[model samples]
Target: MVTVQAKLIFEGSEDKQRVLDLMRRWSSCMRYAYKRLLEGHKRNELKKQLQGIFNLNSRYVDDAIMKAKSILTSCKERGENPKKVVFGGRQLFEKLQKRHINGKAYKKLQLKWQEKRKGNLYSRGDRSKKGNLNTRIEIDEDCTRLRINVGEREYVYARIQPGWKIKDGRYIDRNQLLEAISICGQPYSVQLKLKSGVVYAYFAIEEVFPQPAITRANGVIGIDTNAYPRHVAWVETDEHGQLLGYGRIPMPELESGSFEKKEYYRWQYAHMIVQMAKEKQKAIVIESLSIKDRGRREDFSGRRSRRIRHYFGYRSLLEKVKLLAKREGIEVIEVNPAYTSVIGMLKYAPQFMVSKDVASSYVIARRGLGLRDRIPHNYMMFLGRLDVNELEELKEYVRKVVKNTYVRKKQLREIGRVIKFLQSLESEAERLSVPLDGTSTGSRGKNHNLWQVLKVAVVTPLSPERVLRDLSVLKSLLVSGQVGKTYKGASSCFLGQGLWLSQIPPAGAGKA
Candidate 1:
């Protein structure tokens, strides 16, 4: 199923007011549903509460609460750590449960949210932003128009102007799409959104999709993402995991850009990579990574800050790739990220004379192909230091971050301090090599290089590598404010919770 979203423009004050009234009522309805959830009221109990509250159909309220619960559930799944559902200013206007298109009963509308009507008519709290009528070019639709069927009292929306500017860089008339929908039957869903008096619409169409057979025949293409020096390293192999080809894809543009602009570019990048996989007739493999944090304490440095922002874009990249691949009938695989980088460096990099990222890509591909127990003995030593003094030192730093006086907003700088300290600690470890055979006492100080010791004592149990991995989780916890007393006492309110942040003067704000 492919979902297409479009921007909408409305004509005439009556038409605009009609859309606004629908949005206002819907928002108010969603707020009510959210409050009921917080109060531990079941759907049936909430349904009863809705019966006498609004003169509108009961299905509207039912849809509101379901959408609210669904949104809340998704947020929780993303590790949002939301203590309460905040229906702040943003209101929801979902597709109605029963809709009528061309007089046939269906579920949804061409346009649709706020609440509370005095008597049977919708109360106009404020209408000072009404505009002047003039000859303006506006996009509108009729056939695909949606009507809210409530017995004999129908709310009909025919044409929504300024339609959608699709991937072709041109506005697609809703009327044209509606004709197509009529032929193809009703879509899966049509969503309405109202923000700052601007209306937006989304249409999701379900179509026949063929299952990807590449994974069954060809192996996967593994991609390793490196943020510090931005690049995507990819390795291609057979279904059984023998490497076939490898290359580094440079990501210089990602290093610096506005968040929105960068996100658009990230989508473009993911699209390009997926196109490569499609052409090769192979499934793609990537690490299952999610970094839902602001930044680590170590991000105070300009370079560290850039790295955090760059890596954060990985989530967006992954999402875009998955969506694009699904639409194209391509298989995408995500494997655990445990030791791909380390294993890549220790086993593949030296053997193939490739960069760490390329080697990591190979490891990621292999891991996806069922080779999980192939770690080199030298790297296994570094993994066995769970009870070492360095770990204690790391814990002390983490505790300091949690106990810091700064608010969550200021924790990035604190994380930077921890990162700086980790760098110094690494230097100290290099200075005091900790011995190779696990037998050198401090008084008998062996002056062997740490990585060199591991190489020569390759058969020795448990060794250390030259580079120390950054404690990313420590930074993530700090950035996400999951470590301490951030957001400990915010109150939840039901009324006036909606926010309209856009200053794009509401329709008629411009002197006509």
Candidate 2:
């Protein structure tokens, strides 16, 4: 099933005003339903309450309650502390925004609020100004126009364009009203939204057909999603796990400054993935990543801003891809992500001449194929002798080093400065030479503090070789410019123009 938007044209100012009034009423109904739900009222009871409180049709009241319940349920499922539902507030009427317009207008105040590029929550319309009406609106018998029954024997007829062809063959017109939206199969519900002054009707087209059940596939495409420098590294492999190809799809919205664009691009990217899977006739494999608590961690607090940009939709990609895949008759599989990245980096990256993420994607594909398990022999041996605490300590040290070197370096200049700082810190420590005190003091024994500033001190067991390797990784990251180059005075950022392909090495080449 697919849903498309069919915009409606309101001919007169009064017609537009009437639709706006309907939207306001709808918002009020949603607010009422939400409050009742918070007070422990059941959905059916809330519907009954709305029928008495509002003069809208019974179907409209029921739809309003249903919308509110969906919002409340979604919030609870996400483990969020649902606050008092407010119309035109920061939460943006999660229910009201999506209430059944039933071929009516929906205020685009929230969308405009987002367009300002300001922070979330902006006022577009007052609760008193917006009204909502669901029923009494129907497409004319000829399907060439809409007949909206505003009152007894009183109807507002809006003429609409039949259809307009877009550049990509997708029909969308914000200015012209659409008369009839050619749909495939049967359209179950037609929803309308009025924002600003334009009206858009959404048609939920439901098509039933005999779907062929897919047998076991011989290959799968594995996708590894990264938040920072957002992208999905995908690799295709045979059933036996031998890699056939690899690539990466950069997602610019992960870092896009606009919340609206972030949402739009997220779905756009998901659709692309689903289309790719459909074209290839292969199943999709992805990690069941859960980063709900990522922002709460102290280590992640520094990136809170960037994280917030995409966090709400971090899991949305998976859900969307799965949904589209199901509709397309494509199978999607999830596999354990533990150690896939580690093994991919250490064992497959050099062999395949790909990035760690790409290599991890390869491993993920193979794991989904049930062809790979157990760490390599040497890795297992090393793991056998390492104590749990020692391993954790080493992991922590590496984490701090990488975090300081890569994440912190963004505050300063290129890798050269980083290497210089590490070397100078080492020199300062050597000059002190007397088992420096608990902490190393700077030039004035206080000012230009290296330890505090760098978030790392010249502790023992550090080496130039290690710093060099870290510098090398930092240099590669800087060169790649994973976030993409930014342009001033531009609304959209150029994303992922570069393409990566596996460069299989010679037969006798050294394979790490």
Candidate 3:
């Protein structure tokens, strides 16, 4: 897919006015469509409503509904609240409330806000319609002519010409647009954006480019995206999943910087990763985490909410890498991210002597190669040695905290979740203890999340508070699997009344 931005040349001021009027009407229909769509109205139903409410043809009405539906879908993907969304900038809306301001400045701001509300138009291409039914473009001698259907038979023509865009003191040439539009009868979606009476056209055409000859059968490069101590940990693995090389792509720009700087660095880092994969003739592996599944803003508050919206651009970077990889003909693999960090920290970090993130990439790389992780004998024995009865005592200790502690409602809820999670872990542990005499696979879950059980089992001993974060602790359990006699009472940090008392390693571990 390739998109080019060009300036739409108008023959007269009347033509510009006509486009602006269409944009205003389109925006009005779009808002109505959004309202109806939110009320669970179907696209066909909303289309009928738009045609009756606004002065537009069938194509314009469908486009408005399509655009509105896309916006709603994106909001869902980003976990944004549709109800709290302000059409214009929220800052601009608040500025209108200020009385101590210049009249002209106030009017300019007002105009800008109104423009956002009613200055957008779009139309999807139709191959059967000889390109687009609305913004129809065709070759005209040396240049191309764009014919816009303004009314039920009336039309306006504009010449497609290359334009220059200045950004951060750099001028970007648009000559590629002319080259792209040189071919005729190709379907191209067009979006016209109005700014101070000027119409800028964005032409996007999607085409299936040939896949690169290089393939994933060679090897894989696994990437672990990190926020704090911002950097992307990457590992190059052989086709058999053995680690060959490793490095980190520094991304401090994500920690604190302007949106432009962040965007620039995102591409910079994405290009570097794509180049590495290309040079190694390997496929790229990354987590397939959904943006909407990350967390909702309503579930958190203050800095936590801000972090959900503003923290590391995981989705953005992931998308950038995918785009660049596609263009370079490098294969990109997406693996389930469940417990990759936990498995890495507990199993690979100490064994490989690397940071948690790098270890995570290693696990990811191996997963891409269809390699499965088995629980080490040490941790499995640890679980097998666990006195399942002691978990009940731990729950009792937590119930007392919820009843007597003065923590916030949210914290209490979190503690409740922890208790429930512990109960589930306890059930699994009892199963593990039952098969202490065999090395058969019946000790625990093959259907259940083996890594999740290990996560809870190992994390409880080491930072019991931040169990979910896996904050770089318990990374030494794999170094010397034969070590023993390490035990701590489940009090203090555990917040328990020393109820979780037992031998961490089973006394008869060798027997098992």
Candidates' lDDT values, in order? 0.52, 0.52, 0.70
- Using TM-score, give the best candidate's number: 3
Give the per-residue lDDT of model 2 (tens digit) for 1-512: 44444556778889866655555566578767788888898876667667666666565666677767887888889897767434445555453456673243344545544322221110111123221222212445654555554444456766654365331223455223222323212224445564554666554434453353431275788888866557888987766677888899987656646655566666778888878877777788888775433343335565764455345466877777777677777777888876676556545664566787887888788778876543333222222222334334433444544555543333223222323333443342243232222123454333232222222211111332242112222222122322223354443332211111012112223437
Supply candidate 1's per-residue lDDT for 48: 62
Cα RMSD, each candidate: 20.9, 16.0, 6.9
Residue 35 CA displacement from its true place in model 2, Å: 4.1
Residue runs of model 2 more than 4 Å from their true location after superposition? 1-7, 11-26, 35-53, 71-83, 90-143, 151-155, 161-216, 226-232, 247-280, 289-299, 303-328, 350-354, 385-512
Query: Which residue ranges in model 3 land beyond 4 Å of their true spot?
Result: 24-58, 61-110, 137-145, 151-155, 159-172, 182-185, 212-214, 291-298, 302-311, 388-481, 484-512
Two-way TM-score contest, 1 vs 3, winner: 3
Among these predictions, the greatest lDDT belongs to 3
lDDT for model 3: 0.70
Candidate 1 lDDT over 38-57, as tens digits, reads: 66889888876775675446
True-vs-predicted CA distance for residue 475, candidate 3, Å: 8.9
The local lDDT score (0 to 100) that residue 86 gets in candidate 1 is: 42
Model 2: residue 486 alpha-carbon error in angstroms: 49
Using TM-score as the yardstick, the better of models 1 and 2 is 1
Q: What ranges in model 1 sit over 4 Å off? A: 1-12, 71-86, 90-144, 148-151, 162-183, 204-209, 259-261, 291-303, 310-312, 377-512
Question: Candidate 3's residue-wise lDDT over 1-512, tens digit each?
Answer: 66777778889989878988988999989888887888899997777667777889988999898988888998899999876666766788888878886689999999888887888889998878756889876666577767888898999888877576532223566554545554666788888887776688888877554586656689899999876667899999988988898989887777777877777778788888888898899999999966332333344454653574475788888888888888778888899987788778778877777878899999999888888887776665555444546554544544554444332233434334434433554454464544321112432323345455555445543444443343434433443332323447523333233534333444234543
What C-alpha lDDT does candidate 1 achieve relative to the native structure? Answer: 0.52
